[model samples]
Target: SKFGTIYFWRVHYNDSSDHVNETFSFRPVQPGGGGGGMGGA
Candidate 1:
């Protein structure tokens, strides 16, 4: 796991009435390197 490395991940959660699952990919960034507040999202 290095800087700016992209990885695939899974997220499981409940949406109101039913169960939900999601898959996404995101890049890692250095702390305070760019815009703040959930920069990878």
Candidate 2:
């Protein structure tokens, strides 16, 4: 996967029935973006 590139994914399962999950998309952030941090609660 390339950084800053949009990616798409989905889940599928079958248990005596066929089903499809909602499609989702996300973009990869650059290294050391500094956006992930645990704030004081």
Question: Which stretches in model 1 have alpha-carbon errors above 4 Å?
Answer: 1-11, 14-21, 25-41
lDDT of 1 by residue, 1-41 (tens): 32222212222222222233222222233232233433453
- Show where candidate 2 strays beyond 4 Å: 1-7, 11-25, 29-41
User: For every candidate structure, what is the RMSD over all alpha carbons to the true structure, in angstroms?
Assistant: 8.9, 10.9
Clashing pairs in 1: none
RMSD of 2: 10.9
lDDT of 2 by residue, 1-41 (tens): 32222212222122223322221212223222222321110
What C-alpha root-mean-square deviation, in Å, does candidate 1 show against the real structure?
8.9
Error of 1 at 7 (Å): 15
Model 1, 14: alpha-carbon shift in Å? 4.1
Clashes of each: 0, 0
